[model samples]
Target: MTLNVANCQRCGKVYLKNMYGMCGNCIKEIDLQYDKCLKYLREFRSCSITELSEATGVSHQLITKFIREGRISIKGNPNMTYDCEVCGTAIRENTMCEPCRSKLAKETNQMHEDENRKKLREAQENHNTFKIQDRLKDRF
Candidate 1:
């Protein structure tokens, strides 16, 4: 197995890095916090993100991360609002709001279309350019 080593963001300890950018100890701590938050939610049911974080001592960012991961949902409970990554607009399900997602999709499509057009133009130019020597028969 390949070892990817890095420093833990929470404890500042040197260790093999994982996807969360934190070491195992910190990850466990976060898991415990997630459990705490979940328990609190089950009891409070209607608590807002602020209240949840305040009660559980978990950071707002972590709770948002959990929401983004689809572990926690705010469907009917309007109190829990996941914000848009770009504009911080309250979103329900996804990481981004609908408007932001649409805008991003359009921009991405436009960039790809522009790139393809440039390539096609270059290809046409290369194929259309003719040298006078080509019109004449070879000496052989």
Candidate 2:
């Protein structure tokens, strides 16, 4: 039987394909980094995201991913505020700030409304064109 395999996204080494898509070595390294970050957080309790990254030797992006994935939580630590993904504003929870999120929501709704209007107009135009048979001409 053939086996599933893929190159690790991090180190580019061939590995058995898994859900995470990373090789075992890279996964272990990330796990270690996570442990270090958790330990530091437990001890410090109030470090910013930059500080956590510096202490744990992990990238800010990975830490943000961990927070987004619910692996890291900032609820108890007020100093762990990170920048909003959409804007540079500092945010307490989630990636995007409230304003950015609301703006995106509004834009999405407007797009959907426009699409619906276009569809309705197209349907009306199609329905307006009808084939009328000339019964008198047919008889002639």
Candidate 3:
């Protein structure tokens, strides 16, 4: 695999880019925060993400990232909800709500169909051009 040198998004330090965008130091700090948040949640199982963030001094954004990564689970908690990434609808799990997902699926299918039609038209045009060239060659 190729490694690219990039400035860390968190600390602005130069480092070899891997799976994460942050430098080693920032990654270590985030790991520490994750551990702290996990411990706090284990002790206070009923706490919401915002409450856990306040109690542990971690950001709610990081807690949401943890939830999305499946590092933390907010199961059985109706109060713990996240907005869909595509739509503003409240969702219990995943990035997108069901309606948004269905809409995107239909759009994707339509796009594929349009692309296939374009390719077919190009192929037919090429075939007609080849046929014309063959007819000209026979006359010569």
Candidate 4:
């Protein structure tokens, strides 16, 4: 087996024979993301998967796992909401991160606006066609 030797990212300590390439302290730092997620949830009373993902930079899948395994929950409600950990913005049903929440909102809004504009353009084009047909009919 090739023994892993690497320097700890947090403390800059060089560890020999480390299999994960990170020292114990660095591993703890990695674990801290979960703590951050928990703390964020606690302070906000609830958080969506997207919000947690945004705040902790953790993947939504991992946050979903935490929720599924009963590692997290809302204070009073069995059904939890996802919100921004920093800004407390409500997130999507499955997303826990705030940034993702805002992004989703913006995208949704843009899609709606684009759809409306397309409809209006199509209506105007149809109206113009009808007007042209009327003018041609008059000539005949």
Put down candidate 4 lDDT per residue, 1-140, tens digits, no spaces. 87557677557797874565678877676578778888777766555566667887977766655665566655453336554554655543443475666777899999999999999999888874456678889999
Q: Count the backbone clashes (under 3 Å) in each candidate.
A: 0, 0, 0, 14
Q: Compared with the true structure, what per-residue lDDT tens digits does model 2 show for residues 1-140?
A: 98899999999999999999999999999998888888999999889999999888899988887888888889988898778988889888877999999999999999999999999999988885534565556766
Q: By lDDT, is 1 or 4 better?
A: 1
lDDT at position 90, candidate 2: 88
Which whole-number lDDT from 0 to 100 does residue 28 have in model 1?
A: 94
Model 1, residue pairs in steric clash = none
Model 1: lDDT of residue 50: 91
lDDT of each: 0.87, 0.89, 0.85, 0.67
Report lDDT (Cα) of residue 39, candidate 1: 90
C-alpha lDDT of residue 54 in model 3: 87
RMSD of 1: 4.4
Please report how far candidate 3 places residue 75 from its true position, in Å.
2.7
Highest-lDDT candidate: 2
Candidate 2: count of backbone clashes, pairs at least 3 residues apart or interchain: 0
**Candidates 1 and 2, the one with greater TM-score:** 2
* Candidate 4 weakest ten by summed lDDT: 74-83
Distance from true location, Cα of 59 in model 3, Å = 2.2
lDDT, candidate 3, equals 0.85
> Candidate 2: misplaced stretches above 4 Å?
129-140
Taking every candidate in turn, the Cα RMSD to the unseen true structure, in Å, is: 4.4, 4.3, 5.1, 10.9
* Candidate number with the higher lDDT (2 or 3): 2
Error of 1 at 119 (Å): 1.9
lDDT of 3 by residue, 1-140 (tens): 95589999999999998689999999999999999988987777777767888899998778889889988788944467667888767787989999999999999999999999999999988874456778889998
